[model samples]
Target: MKHILLIPENEKPTLTAAIINTLLVSVLLIALFWISLNQIQMTLDFSFIGTYRIRLIKGFGMTVALGLIGFIISFFIGLLSALGQSCKILAVRYFCNLYVMLIRGTPLIMQIYLFFYILGTAWGIENRFVAGILILSLFEGAYIAEILRAGIQALDPEQMEAARAVGFTRKQTVRFVLLPQLIVLTVPSLTGQFASIIKDSSLLSMIAVIELTQTIREITATNFKLFEGYLFLGFLYLCLTLPITLLSKRLERRFRHEA
Candidate 1:
């Protein structure tokens, strides 16, 4: 009798099998992590969480607020910059290109320090929160501009011709024909960028912004629960970003289906 394979090489896994395998891998990874922690004789005590819950909550709120405000401001900046890149005036196009290139090329930490300390002090911007929002917006706007520019460029040239043929004014064409498709194309990336904004907001802590990371740092400084504090910080960020990631995936699928 010929030996038979339990499953064919090219066969797709069943849902039950996939679930079982995922659970098995998860358990194995957890077990390995537990073993590594034991080997290092490190213990994580989260008992202080209850005592510092109010501060943590406040810090979490601050992070969310910064991300929301930064996203809104940066989105307009990006939109205008992207449009500027296509302008008839060479100066406008060059300025937008230089802005994107400078912001994108430099490290964000360096930009944060320079903006907050040098430009911010010279401009007499005393409030850390306001300065943090501006810095974050400036950094993330470069990335958003690139995303929007790519989406704009990806459209067929024939679409513009068709719109003009239909007697649509340039503004009307942009409002009706371009914006809708651009939104659909860029939604996934924009959602993902929001997740990035939340994480990047942590860097504002360096400038004494009282966001999530800064709060965790203060707690860790007093309590000396560095690992536990940062671990919980990661958990809190996951709470924010995981949903965004899921939403991005869902939108990508919907867009693909519509296409």
Candidate 2:
């Protein structure tokens, strides 16, 4: 014998504060969109946007690839610069410092222009893509060198002392004891630098590298959809950066757990 419980179909669920808040947010967003549309007085034509979808996709890929290649090259440059800065030779240290200072002091666009012109003149390298890689790597290398230097310096001096006590030479100590810890300490900073490099890659479009920003410019020039074009470009960049940011956070957490 089962007692049948009959629920009234006319009963309505009460709206929670969370649901009300979400509704309010949606309404606010709709209002903002209306305001923007009225102010701009332009039709929201996504047809133009779709026209350059392939180019945008290519540019997005190129931007990410360029950033990654630049990051790798800059890391090596930074590592070498860091090692050189810590060298016994005063001349090498001074040269490394000069390189860092020179790059840091100048504008990135100026660096790109100079690299393009000077490298073109001296080495017959006229490819803007190649030039962009070199420029970004060199620009980021200086900053990354400082980051690496700080990471290396942050370590307890006793570690190096213990390594030397165990018959490790100066080079061996750096290779084994110093480098592994340096890598862990510098990961967060390097991740930030990589993000910075991706943003900086947009400037390469000025040199006709046809990356994301260039694609945006090309699209907007066709339909005068400047706002939408830039908004889309910004979204594409966010798409590229957000993943790296999340991954960096995850890596930081994982490393912290391991430590």
Q: What is the lDDT of residue 86 in candidate 1?
A: 99
Q: TM-score of model 2 relative to the true fold? A: 0.81
Report the C-alpha lDDT of model 2 over 48-84, residue by residue, as the tens digit: 6677788988988899989999999999999899989
Q: Give the alpha-carbon lDDT of every model.
A: 0.93, 0.86
Candidate 1 whole-model C-alpha lDDT, 0 to 1: 0.93
Query: Per-residue lDDT for 134-222 in model 1, tens only?
Result: 99999999999999999998887888889999999999999988878888889999999999999999999999999999999999999
Q: What is every candidate's alpha-carbon RMSD to the true fold? A: 3.1, 8.9
- Which residue runs of candidate 1 sit more than 4 Å off their true CA positions? 1-13, 166-171
Please name the candidate that would achieve the greatest TM-score relative to the true structure.
1
Superposed on all Cα atoms, model 1 deviates from the true structure by an RMSD in Å of 3.1
Estimated TM-score for each candidate? 0.92, 0.81
Report the Cα lDDT for residue 244, model 1: 98
